[model samples]
Target: MKKDSKSLYYKDYLKLDELLSSQSPRSKELGKEAHDETLFIIVHQVYELWFKLFLHELDFILKLFREKEVDESNIGRGVESLNRILEIQQLSIRQIRLLETMTALNFLEFRDLLFPASGFQSVQFRMIENKLGLDENMRLKYGSSSYKMPLAKPDASEVTKTEKEPSLFKLVEAWLERTPFLEFKNFFFWDQYSEAVNNMLAEDKRHISENPNLSADEKTFHLKEYASTEANFEAILNEDAHHVLVREGHRRLSHKATQAALLIFLYRDHPILHLPFKFLSKLIDLDESLTAWRQQHALLAQRMIGTKIGTGGTTGNVYLSKAAETHKVFTDFANLSTYLIPRSALPDLPENIVKNLGFYYSPESDES
Candidate 1:
């Protein structure tokens, strides 16, 4: 048992007095206070607090991936951090529902007091986005200017600095590229996987051509659709084609990294791969949760203002909607499902490789 030298009071420990006193709404300062203004200020302040927590968790996860060889236990811990982030993101979306409790008419009571101070000015949120590897070039312009144009010089500079750092996406990609099982002696994962995919595609084509239920026109249409899907598989199988997609901004993950992720998804049952698979899945979950939050925020703004400009001089919900559509980080991981084959269709690994992938123990025999 351990005892503190000094007794700690809850109020003093949390600085509750300072926290409770920080919510002075602009409407209140203007001599005529609006009731909803207090709620507005509190909600935004709470959002900033959650943003801070996101950065804290992200910093830990980033550190794990930055190592030359991340341990399996560290990956498990990273997955746990991602799970916390996803839970907080869900709460953030629910918090929007709470904000919606104030009607549009009520919001108007104090909305005018918040001029030129947009959510775009949230430096911490921007840092979170950058740390997660949201490509700055892909960001939608904020009212004919860069997203950082709305921020104060110091905040903008801080965001600019964060963009230069290696994000979780980059580090994870590097880690995946270093994965060992992609090639094991005489067994090459890509060769086996590609052959299986071709067999599946050939079966699909035969089915489409021979189906009695489909008319000639329907068969033609289906074959065209099948060809498109087959081309997608081809792009991944061909390194040059994959590189072309990367050059054109259609894909973000490098070819080796993409293959490694697919290997993880396809062979997730392997004991050694289970944690890596979970880690990758959690990244996709985090991206999805953020996208949901952004979409929910956009809807809330649309409901509150109805096509009006934002107090920060942006185009209100339109910009928000566009950002929601494009600001995704781990979509490549999610899209790996496109190439997944059934466990039954997967190639069998060599005995040596299987032993490496598994956790097994056998007592040795001794002869006298």
Candidate 2:
């Protein structure tokens, strides 16, 4: 055991004096304090603290991805980091429930004092979005102004710099592009997978055509819908077509990255691939959690002040709801399930590749 030269006090260590004194509600400042104002201030302060923790974890994950080759242990660490973020996001959603307990009238007691200082001005939240690679062009604009328009100049500059840096989405896509199991000597996976997909679609068409219960019009409609799904899978099989979708902003993951991701998903049961698969799954989970929090916040705002303009001057619930629906960073990865086939329908990997994708641990090998 090691002992420091000077003993540290608990209050001094966490700076409790500074922290406990930071929450001076505006209603208190106005000489008539409201009961709910303390809760409002504390809730927001807790969120900012959690946001700081998110950035700390994100910095480590980004460092791992920036390396030329990430180790397997590092991938596990990255998954752990994402898992922490997921937990934090769940807390964020739950905090809304706590805020709602203040009631609409309770909120109104101090809400006017918060004029021109809404969640839109939260620089930390904007930083989280930018670092996760929310596309700038796709953002829900407020009266033709940038989302950053509400930020102070210094904070706005930080957001701008973050945008120029490589985001988590781009880094993950690049890492997936460098994945090894997608191709093997004399055994390309995509070609075989494409053939399987065609056969599956053909079987579906046959089933639809032979169904006696379906009217001719219903059958025709189902066939058309089936065709659309087949064409989408076809786009994945064709690199040039995938590129066209990327150009149109309908997709963000590169063709190589998308293929590698699909391969991992299709063969996730392999011992070596399981961790990477979990990492990808965590990304989708993180995105979904954040979206849930955003929607919860929007609904809370609507409940507090029906359709009114935000304290920050934007259309309150409308802006938040639109952002909740559209502001996703891992949408492309989630949509990859559209290309997934059942385990039975998956194309079997070559034997050598299966070995490569497995973590063999025989006694002889371990001794060696």
Error of 1 at 356 (Å): 2.0
Candidate 2 lDDT tens digits, 42-148: 99999999999999999889999998877688899999999999899889889899989988998889888898888888888888888889868979886889988
Give the total clashing residue pairs for model 1: 0
lDDT of 1: 0.88
Model 1 residue 322 lDDT? Answer: 88
Q: Estimate each model's TM-score.
A: 0.93, 0.92
Q: Which lDDT values do the candidates have, in the order given?
A: 0.88, 0.86
RMSD of 2: 3.9
On a 0 to 1 TM-score scale, where does candidate 1 land against the true structure? 0.93
